[model samples]
Target: MKNLNCKNCGGPMLIDPSGTTANCPFCGSKYVLDHRDTDYYRDFYERMRGFLHLSADGQERRRRADELWDSAASEVFECSDGRQIDIRSMHTYKNRIMTAYTARQNIIFRFDIGNEDKADRYRKNVSSIDYPSADTRSLSDFFPRISGGFELADATTLLVVKKREDEYPLRLFGTLSGRHTAWLIGRMENLCCVLEYNSIVHPEFGLDTLYIDPYDHQASLYGGWWSAVPNNTAVNGRICTTRDNLTALRETAAKVLGFESASAARETEDVPKPFADFLRSTPLSNAYEDFAYWDDVLIKSYGERRFINMETDDKQIYGKGQ
Candidate 1:
């Protein structure tokens, strides 16, 4: 049985292999562990991390990204303060890459879409969605694609840099800190926390530490974009499980994108309204109390997503729509 960490307290998870839920050590909250959520992000993370490991394709992709940036750089003109505007995001699909540009503290923005991956999901998500901040383009289209920590385990390195006379955008700059995202859905348990990374070889304050507050959109339960996260989680939060642990993502690109600059600025958290009605769907033991055939009703892991696919074998695949 694979182990899952607490997304709330960032401690070892107490999970029953046969059970669908797990509890947080620091905060005392329960979460449903759905397989789909776990596997999808895991695939996504692995795929992206693979891109970092490829000795042959890495240079080619970076070179191509640079060439594309060169063609678009000419379009940028000086801002009133002479601040430069250049590609901020280089989102690559099978063959094509879409580069987004923003300048002067994000006051101006544009995008450069190139390549030929007709099956490209990046093009679909980013091209049409309405961006949140006025000047910057919205990149939410990849919301379902790059959604969590499973991708982090595969990331043995990171790439960060300046716009080079158009050096390949975002090449060799900083170390990345990522993690598993799904099973770690937030709960009010343990109230324990730590910083975590399976490969931290040095004496760090222990693995990972975190606090749990279900109401915070930035809570481990939801996804946070700026924090280099595909799911909603805050630093110093728990680390049991996440979508990243289970995905098989391929051909990926990301960096410390930016903060408080997109519509997806934070998680949308609130005590679920119709709180009582919503509770009816939760697979809590007492929730099955109202019905006589209670034992037959299984409490799902995570939330509504798994609840729907529970009875039958799962048929969904990542990168196929999500």
Candidate 2:
């Protein structure tokens, strides 16, 4: 038996090795075990936290995140702006390495560094879809939306830059004492929200090549483009990616890519409508609800893409004339 806390009540509970259900003693709530994976537990706990309106715990989460940033900044690389660029993030993925470094100041400087091999792979995969002419020009030509020109330094590292405002086409967000970092983070989260949406709508998307260019608040996911800039919420303000525009974009892309959905997936299951719903119902204080809501969106977006892809492949095999 393993001791764990109840997701709903946060009270103590014990799990039997032979049993599948976890019953909460205090709340009398029962949750079925799902694979018992670490990620499943994380999600389970997060969902419970959200259900309990546990934003108060966010302060601790924020503190831990601050510590991570501080640790990342412990060893600094000086930048042109007299501020330091630290390794804000870096990790290895199979044969590839992905890293993000930042200098938070009046003008933020963020550099996304990856392995040349990985960059080349991405370049090859996305170029044809992005470039109608099949032009294999420079990296900038390949991902034109990325203002930060590619820096192919040595045989190892490939760097792409993006910022709030690109003085040099690719830079970092910096305005009034790191205010843009929040926006940059928000931009990244928004892209994840979209990717989560895509993962549900198309399971194969896998978010493997999900790229968010904060410079323009846009994203590229498995060759599809997405607008991820957050909408203002003034009393009479409007939301980004209105239902009409999203439907148009989806239909246009589907037609261009020859995605003939015999039975089109429900539009409400995607991010646009549900996100809009979140914006309407969720108060400013419960901003954390947005992440939980988007997670649900991502889960729902899966499998739908797999079916569409299969149908598209069938069309390719049978013949476009048919």
Candidate 3:
């Protein structure tokens, strides 16, 4: 009620009225309420108002967001090394909701290592590897250098933008509805990297994709087609790949280059007008431009024959050397 710090990790804490518990958003820990404090409920209620924009449109958007969250699967998922992880909803906000409303469709994953004893060590790893600490291979150097505004959010959340010039930095929304959340959980195991998971479902051509560094191309420089819509598909282009994360790196790549398809692949009919308005308000840049910029930079440094993952001729063949 006092905006007190989290007892477990000392991060900011918020009160959850439904559960009668105080929660730490930074570290998914909960604590019992001190019911003796009669003012606690009133204080929390006041605090929650700021968290929720209670205007008519805000209430409607909140309702829709709650529906999206309620629909999210509650089963816990196991990571690569078998750590049990759960998907928790932290906060939601509709950028600029208009008429017909749809759930926010982007998700920015910021992973936290939960080993209490190893907290310091995890921070070290995240700062040294996830951040660009003299490591050219760090995401900061890799994504921003390559193209697009693959900017790091809080040194961990990778805000995936179509072009480096897009002024509005897109936050990853948890609106993919199902398997994507599980995919993100598995991918974050033992890895301190940010990821952007998105799905554009429209009447014409829907798209689902996520972006991260190449699995084996650890040289610090980084990184799809479209399948027909499935029968009764809520979204189009159910692209698949070798990676279990369900990310469309192998397909639907218009976000990182200056290619024509990238421009053609707009979300006009697919998403709600509010999100489209939010996107339009920003200095929209195509993902191809970002890809092309990185391509040129990598080419200049690694030479004409450098192994770029996006190129057909330069593609990595898994077990085979590039």
Best by TM-score: 2
Model 3 agreement with the true structure over 1-322: per-residue lDDT tens digits:
1345578887656444332455675678878767653255544333322222223354654564464356343323354444543433223211111001112232223223322222232233223323323552444532322111121222222221121210111112212211121122223211212221121111111122223222222211111111212223443354421121112321122222111232233333222233222222321132233234433433433335433332222122122334
Off by over 4 Å in 2: 1-86, 90-144, 149-154, 161-204, 211-322
Model 3 spans > 4 angstroms off: 1-57, 73-125, 129-322
Instruction: Between candidates 1 and 2, name the one with more favorable TM-score.
Output: 2
Candidates 1 and 3, the one with greater lDDT: 3
Q: Write the per-residue lDDT of candidate 2 for residues 109-218, one digit (tens) a residue.
A: 22234344554544443333321133422223223233232433322333343332111111111110111122223333443344333221221121122333322334
lDDT of 2 at 250: 30
* Model 3 worst lDDT window (10 residues): 93-102
Each model's TM-score?
0.18, 0.25, 0.19
The model with the greater lDDT, 1 or 2, is 2
TM-score of 2: 0.25
lDDT of each: 0.25, 0.31, 0.29
